[model samples]
Target: MRTWIRGLVLATLLLPAFPACGQGGDGTRPSPSIERPSVPSASRRLTLDEAQAWHGRHPRLLLAADDVAALRARRATQPYDRIAEMLLRRADEHMALAPADVGKAALAGPDPMPHVLQRLAMAGLLTGQRDYSRKAIAMLAALGEQGYPRRDRSVAGAGDLAVGLALAYDWTYEFMTAAEQRTIQRQLAALATEIEASMSPDGGTFGKLAAQEGMAGHHAVALGGGGLGLMALALRGEVNYLQSNAWQTTAEACLRAYYRDAFGSDGAGIEGFELTLRALGAALPCTIAMRRMDGVDLASATALGSVPAWAAYELLPGPSTLPAGESGGGLGSQDAMALMFAACPDNAAHAWLYDVTHGSRGRASFGRAAAGDASFAGPGAGDVMTLLAYPGERADAGPPALPLGKQFPSAGLAYFRSGWGDPAGDAVVAFRCLPRPHLGRWHLDVNQFTFHACGWGWAIDSGPGWEAADGEPTLTPTVGVAAHNLFQMDGREAAAPCGRTLAFVDDKAGWGLVVGDGSHAMGVTTFRRYLAVGKRDGRPRYVVVIDEIDPAPAGQAANGPQNPATAGEPPVHQYRHFLHTGAGNRVDLSGRVATLTTPDGGTGQFAVVSPPEATLKVAEIRTHAMGTHPRIEAQHATAGRFYFVAVLVPRAAGDERPIAVRPEGRPGPAIAFRVTADGVTDRVCVLTTPEARPPNGFGKARHRLQLSRGDLTQSLLFDLEEPGHDAPSAPDSAPGATPTPAP
Candidate 1:
C-alpha cells in the first residue's frame, strides 16, 4: 500500500499541466483567464482543466439533499426550532465581526473563527439565505488568500483551520464561484501537505512518529485524524493531489486506532474528562460523516458503544467530574452528546445524556440565568454540529436504570455512587490505579481517590500540575505524591509504578468494595488499599478505607536491619498518609479524628482507627491556581508491618446523625473495625498476609474480607494469582445474585 501511494505521488508530481476541458487542441474556445489568488509560496494552484475534471456533489460531507430538506421541514418543530434559532442568532453575530487575520501569530484564547464560519455556513444552508452564504464565502476567500500561517503552531490549531475550511467549502459549495472553488482547493491542498509533513518521522509540530503511533494520542486522533481527515474526505475527488487517498486511508486508520488505544474498552478516555470531550468533538463528527457519505459504520468498530455510560459515570454531584489527569472539572459538551446520540440513536443512555445536557431543559441549565441563556449550556450550545447531529425526539431515561458502579479495567479507574439524579442526596467516589503504562498527560496518581457527597467535593485532586499567570509559568505545590491521597515511605517520593486492581465487588444494594495492589507505588513489598462504600436506606452513609503496608516479603523478618545508614538497628520507614480537601472547606483535628465542614454546611468526619501511636495534623497546601486548601497529614513509624484503617461519614446540613468508630479485635495480620451511623452498626475485617489460616472467624484465606451487619454477612475472597474477581456471594446469600436489600 505504501509503495503504491508513493508511486501515485511521484507520478502526479511529474505530470504536465493541461489546457481547459472545453478548449480544442487549436484553442477554438479560449478558457476564462484564471486569476491566481495571493497565497503561500509553496501552494500550487490547480489549472482550470484540473478543476473542471474534479467531480463532487454539493453539501456532501455532513448533509445530503434529502437531509437538508428534512431539516428545513422540521425547522418549526420543537428541538430543531430552538436550535435553528440559536444558529441564526449566532450567524447574525458573525456578520457583525470581521474575518480573522490568519497570517498573524496565534493568540492565547481559542480561535473562534472556525466555529464562526461553521455557524454562518450552516445558517445559509438551512435558511437559503444568500446574505449568510456571501458572508461565509468572503471569510473563506480571506482564509484561502492569507493561508493560515499559525496552522503549524499545534496539531489542534491545524485541525481547526482544516475543519473550518472543509465545512465552509462543502456546505457553501453551491454558492461559490468557479474562481472561489479553485482558490479554496489550492489552500486545502496546501493544508493537507502540511498535515502530512507533521505526521512524518522528521521533527514537526507533533514530533517524531510511527504511522500507527502518530494516531495513538487523543490530540492526534482528534485533531490529526478527525480534523484533518474531514478535510481529506471533503477534498478527495475535488483535488488533483494523489496524497488525498493516503490521507483518507490514514484518517480511517486513526478512527480505528483511537478506539483501540486512546480510549479504554469501557469507553473511558485515558486523559480524563476535558480532553475526552475535545477528542470526541472531532472523532464523533468524523464517524458520522463517514457513515453518511460512504455508508461505513466506524462507530460500531470502536469503544464508542460504551462512551455514554462512561460519561454518565464520570458526572459527579455538582455536574462536574474529577480532575483525574490534566482536566479542570466540568460537564461534557452537548455537541459531543448530540453526536453520540446520532451514532447510537437506539441507546437509551445516549439519548438520556443528550436530553439531560441539552441546551434548554437539562441539568446544564442549573445555576444559570434562564433556559436559553448562553452560559447555561457552555459554548457548545451555539455549535452548528449539535444542530446537524441532533436526533429528533426520544425518551429521556434517567441513569437509575444503569449500574450504580462501573469499572474501566483497561484504564484502571472505578466509579461508585449511592444513587442517581439527586445532586444533594447522591454520594460519588472515583478511584484510579492504572495498571497500564502511563504516558501523555497521565499523572503519577496511582492508588489515588476522590470523594463527593451532599453537593460538595469532600476529598479532591490537585488538578493539573502546570498553570500560567499573566504569561509567566507558576509552579504549584500540587504534583506527584504531594497532590494525591496516598502514602509516602521514609519521606521520599516513590517511583511511578503500574498499580493493579485485585478485586471488585458491587452488590448494587448500596454495598461495594474495590481492592488495589499498590506496593510498587509505595516503595514497599506489600501495599494494598481496600476501599468500600455503604448506603443506608437507599442513601449513601459512609466510606471505609484500609491500607496495609509491609516493607519485606513474606517469611522474611520485616524488622531486620536493612538500611546501611542504621547498621545493627531494626529497619523503620516513616510513613505519611495525606488527604486534601476542597477549597474553602475547614478542617479541624482532635485526637485521631478530623472533621471537615463545607461552605454549604455539609460535614464529614474522618477517623483513623489503626496505628495507635499515629499523629494527625492539618496544614495548608497550594493546589495550583485554585488557591490554598487544607490537607490532613497522618504520620507513623514502624519497624515491621502495620495498617491504616479509616472511616469517612458524610452528613447533610441538618441531618444530625451520631457517628461512632471503634477498633475491632485483630485476627493475625489483619485489621477490623466497627462503624455505627444512622442507627446501623457495620463491622469489617481485612486480611493482610499473603497466606494465612488463622483460627479466627476469617478461616483459611489470604486477601480475604468479612463484613457483617445485623443478620446479613458478606465474605469476599481475593486471589492474587488472578485479579478481576467480582464480589463473591456471602455464605448466606445466593451465588451470582445481587445481595438482598435490607428491610
Candidate 2:
C-alpha cells in the first residue's frame, strides 16, 4: 500500500495534466472520470470477450494486456547494467519481503515501477488464481505506504499509486467481494483530495505537461503520465472509485488543454520525439476508454509523425539529427524499443511502451532480448512488426509519405536495425547527407551525407571524433551546416570559416535552410529536394538537390588582402559544388553530374539534368574543386580534397537503379552535378568584391571599381543560355577545374 501510494505520487508529481487535452471548456466535450474494468491475467494468451467485440467493429482496436508471467519473463532477462540490475533486484526483494501488503510496489522508479506491478496483477487475474492477486495487492499497498519519493515533487507519488490501484481494480474487480472493493476505495479516496494542489492552469502543475527537466531529455514524460493515469481508471472498473469528483475534475482539465493547445493545429510534437511517443501510446487506451463511456474520440489526435517513430526506427539508423548526441537525431534506444513495442497491440502505442520498458535508465539501455524470446528475425522483421498492423493511408492520395516535419528532419538517415526478423537484410537506408565531422555544430552539412541499405551503411558520414595531425580538424565539424552537402559560397566554410564566411539562418517557410556570406559572396539556399526510387534500369539511385542563389557580392573592404594567398583581386564570380557518396566503389564527375557506380554496375548520381519537359533550360557546364568547409591546405588556394567512396553495397538484381541517358551522355542518378550557362545555372556560386573606401579625400579612384553585384535570378537565367558561352559582361572562368566524382 505504501509503495503503491508512492508510485502514484511520483508519476503524478513528475507530470501533471495531459497535453493532448486543452485547459478551457470550449465547445469540446467534458473530460470523463478515470475508470477500470476487470481484465483476466492468464499464462496462455486469451482474448477477452469485450476485446473481441471491440475489434470486430473497429478492426484497429487494441486491447489491454493481462499476461504477467509473460511480461515478467520478458522483463527479467533484459540486459541490464549494474545500476539497472540493482534497482530490479531491490524491487523483487521488496516485493518478496512484504507479500501481504500492496504498499511495497513502489520499490521501482516512481512512475514506471507501479506500472510493472499493475501488469503483474492483471496477469494474475486472468489466470483465475488468488495467489497472484494477493501478491500484487500487497505490493501495491506497500508502495502506497512508502510513497514514491523524488528530489522534486511528491505529488508524483500519487501517479504511481494511481496506476497500481487501477491495475488492482482492473485485474481483481471480478473476484473482489464488496468488502474487498471498500478496502481499496478507502486507500485511493484520500489521495484524490490533494490532486488540485498539483494542477497547473495549462495542466502542467507538478510538472506533468510541463517540460520536467528540460524540453530535450525525457520530454515524453509529460505526455506519458496522462496515459498511465487513464490506464489506472480503466483497469479498476469500480464506478465509485472513478466517479470521485476530484479525479474527474483533473481529467477534464487535462483533456481540454491537451487538444486545444499542447499539440499544434497541424499535429506537430513541438516537444520532439520522446513526448510524441509517450502521448500517443498512452492515448490509445485513454481514447478507447473515453469513447466507450462518454462518446469522446481522441484517435484523431495529431502530434504523430507521418510514418510513426517506430516505423522509422525499424527502417532507418543514423545518429540523431537533433543536437542531443552524435549517434543520430532520434532517441538512442529507439531501434530496440521499436522492435519490442510491436507485440503490445497498437503498433505506434506499442512502440512507446517498448521504450518505456527500459525504465529510468533511458531507451539506450533497451535491447532486443526485452521483446521476448520469439526471435524477431526476417525481411523487415525488426524493421516493422506489420504482421498484425495496418498500413498508413495518405489523407490526400498516393502511397502515404511521411509529413514534411516527419520526413525532413528524419530524412536520408541510415541506421542499424539489429533485432529480430530476417537475418539476410541487416541495413536500412536514409538517403540524406550527414554533417561532416569537424563542423562545430550538429547542423546537417549542406552537401555532406550518409547512405544506408543492404544490411550496411555503405556511403556514410565519417563520424566526428577524428584527431587532426596538427591540432586542426582531422575531419569536418561534428557540428554545423557545412558538414552536410547542400552548397557553399566563394569557397568559404560555413559554421567556422577562414578564407570565406558562411552561416545557417532560419527559414521563413516551414523548412530549415542554409545562408552563406563569404569574403567575396553572399548566398542563400532557397530550396532543397530529396528523391528515391527502386533501382531505375537496375541502378539504385537516391538524389538530393539544393537550389541556391547569391544576389550580391562582398564589398572590396571585406575581401582586400585578408591574407597573402588572397592578395590578388577576388574572382568576378564563382560557383562551388559538393557531392558526397555512400558507395565508395567508383565515382566520376563530368559535364553537369557526379556519378557513383558500384563494382557490380549499380549506380547513384548527383546531377542537374532536364526534368522531362519544363520550359526551363540548363547552360554553363563545368566541374571544379570539391567544395567544403575550410581546413589545412596542401596548396595555398586548395582546401579540402574529394574522393569517391570505396567498395560497398553488393551487386544484385532488383537492388540497383536502371541506367539511363541525359542530354550530356551522363549515366543515371547523378550523385553530384552542376551547369552554369547563360541563365539560371545549376552550379553552386561564390562571388567576391573589394571593400568600400572610407569617406575621405585620399581615397583612390580605382577603389570605386572594386564593386560587383551577384544575382541568383541572373545565375538561373545564365543557366538557360547555351553552354560554351561566357557571361555577357564578365572575365573567363578561373582556375582549379578537376571534374571529380561524388563517392
Candidate 3:
C-alpha cells in the first residue's frame, strides 16, 4: 500500500467521531479483534451439495490445459506480434525462468505483488513449468502470515490481491500438491475474511455505516465499493488453490450491495472518465471470472456498452482522448478488455464496439500470425486473459457506419459530428452538461466544450483539472476554467454538479443543438446556453453559441472585470468568453469579427451577432500559469441583460465568402438573426419565461431551430425539449427540411 492509503486509514480512525457514523458505535475504528474474526482453513470443505449447486461453472479458472495447448500450438505455426503470440511468448519466457528466480523477482516491484504473482502462475502453467507455478503459490501464502500486505481492502487494494490469488489458484489447480493447496487455502480464508471485515456492517471501532462512504459529496458510493462483493463471489467454495465454500453469505450480500449502492441499475460511472475506465478494468475481469469460476453471470453489473459513451464524453478524437503519460488520466488502452467489454451479452452494442476497438492494440493483437515465432522476455499485462478468450477471424466485420451524432444521457455527454465516418473534413463537438454536480476532475469541465474540425482538436478540453494532484479541482488557482471553452464571471471556472441539458436535437439537415441550463454551474440566478452545430451543403459550416445569463439575484454581489477607464471613469461589468485552441492557430481580428486559421489551412469565424453592446477582441494568449504554448481567447463585455451570440464556423480557408453574422435589430429575449452564405436566412426566437410553454412541432431538426421571419409569426411556440424528428420549426416552413447532404 502507498503511504497515502495508510494516511487515509489513519485519517478515518483518528478523525472525529461524528453522530451515528460508520465503523463503530460512534464512528471510530473498531478493535482489530472484533473487526476481523478468525477463520481456520483446516476444517473447511466443499460439500457435495455446494458443488452440485455450482455445477455449471467451468471446472477451470478461465483457461484450461487445452486452451493453453492450443495457444502454444498456434505460437509454433502462426507467427505474429498479435494477441495470441504476445501471451504465448510471455508464458514461454516464464517457463525458462527458475522457480526461485520468479519468486525473487515478484517481490521487486513497487507493489504490484499480487499482479506479479498471478502473472507468474498463469504464464508458468501455459509453458508447463510446475515448479514455477508452485513458487508463486508459496510466496503468496507467505503474504498470509501478515495481515495480507495489501491495504485499502474496500475499493481495490485488497481486492486486487484477492483477485490475483483467485486467478492463480484456479489456473494452477491441477499442479498444486495437497500440502500446497492447504497452505494456499489457509491464506485465502484469512485474506477473504479480512477483506469482508473492512466493509462489514459491525463497523470496526467506527460507526457501522462508516467504513467507507462517498468521497466527493456528490457520489453515493465510491469506486471499488463493489469490489469486496465481487471478491466474495469468486472466492466462495474455493480455498487457496482448491474450490470451497467459506464466505458465501458475505459474498451474496456484498454482490447485492454492489448493484444497490455502487453502480446501480443504470450503467453510468460517476468517478470521472479515466477512473471510471479503471473501474471498468477491474469490473470486466471480475464479471468474466465469476462466470468462468462460479457459473454466476453478474451480467447486470456490466457497464452495458459504456466504454464508447465514455469515449464520446471526451472532447477530442483520437485513439484515446486521455493525455498520454498523464498520471491522473490513465495508464493505457488494453484491447482485450475493450473487446470483451464491448462484446457484452446484450449484443446490442457489439457492432459499435467492434468498430471502435478494431484498430486498438488489443484488438489488432488477436488471432493473427506475425513475422517471427518470437516470444516476450517477460510477462505482459493481461496476457493470460488474451489466451483464455480471443475472438477468431469469423466475427462480423462491423456495422455500416458510425452514428452522425449521439447523446449519452447518463454521462451527460452529447456528441455532434458532421459525418466522421465519411470524409476527412469531419467535425465533432463534445458538449459537457453535468445533469447534476459531478465532483471530481471531470466536474471541473461541466458546461465546457471541446470542438474538433479539419481532423484535429481546434478547441480542446482534454486534460485533468489538476495534473499535479488527484481529487476535487481548484478552478481559479489552476488552468481549470481556462482549460475549457466557457464564459467567465469574476474569473472562476464553471462549478461542478452544475448545468443540465434542457434539450438535445439533431436535424436531418446536418444540424444539432444542445441546450443546457448552466445556472448552478455558473453560480448565477438564471443561465442557459444553446450550442448549435450547422452544416453548409453537407460540410461543417459553422458552430453557433447563444448564451443568456443573469449573474445573481438582486442582492447577491457579482464580481467581474471592468472595462479600462480614463481616470475616474465608472466601472462597467466585464463579461468574457474564453476559448483554448489547437497547437497551430492564427487569429485574425476585425472589430467584433475574428477569423481563426487552423494549421491545416481551415478557417473558422467567431462573430458576435447579438447583444451588440458587447465589444470583442481575439488574441493569442499565453501565460506562465496557463501554459507555454499560446491559446485563443475571445473577450466580450457588455451592459444590460446579458445576451451573447456568436457563429464559430470552420471551413476550407479558400472557400466562398463566410456567412455574415450581425444582430438583426432591437433583439429581445425572443429574437436573434443570421444569414448563411447561400442567401438563406434564419430568425431565432426564444421564449424563456418560467411560465412559458412550447408548441410541440419540431421533430428531428428541433436543434437547428431554423425558422423564417414568417414562421415566427405563427406564435413563439418552439418546444424542442426532448427527443424529436425533423419536421419544421414552425408548422408552416419547409426550407430546412432536407439537409444539403453532407458536403
Task: State which candidate has the highest TM-score.
Answer: 1
Error of 3 at 70 (Å): 4.1
lDDT per residue as tens, model 2, 217-237: 122232334434454344333
Candidates sorted by TM-score, best first: 1, 3, 2
Q: Choose the strongest candidate by lDDT.
A: 1
Q: By descending lDDT, how would the candidates be arranged?
A: 1, 3, 2
Computed on alpha carbons, the lDDT of every model, listed in order, comes to 0.61, 0.31, 0.45
TM-score of each: 0.78, 0.43, 0.67
lDDT of 3 by residue, 646-685 (tens): 6665556455433445344444543344434332333333
What value of lDDT does candidate 1 attain over all alpha carbons?
A: 0.61
Considering lDDT, which of the candidate structures 1 and 3 is the better prediction for this target? Answer: 1
- In the range 331-403, model 1's lDDT, one tens digit per residue, is 5555566677677768776666555555342553212222233222222333476667666556456563777
The weakest ten consecutive residues by lDDT in model 2 span 4-13
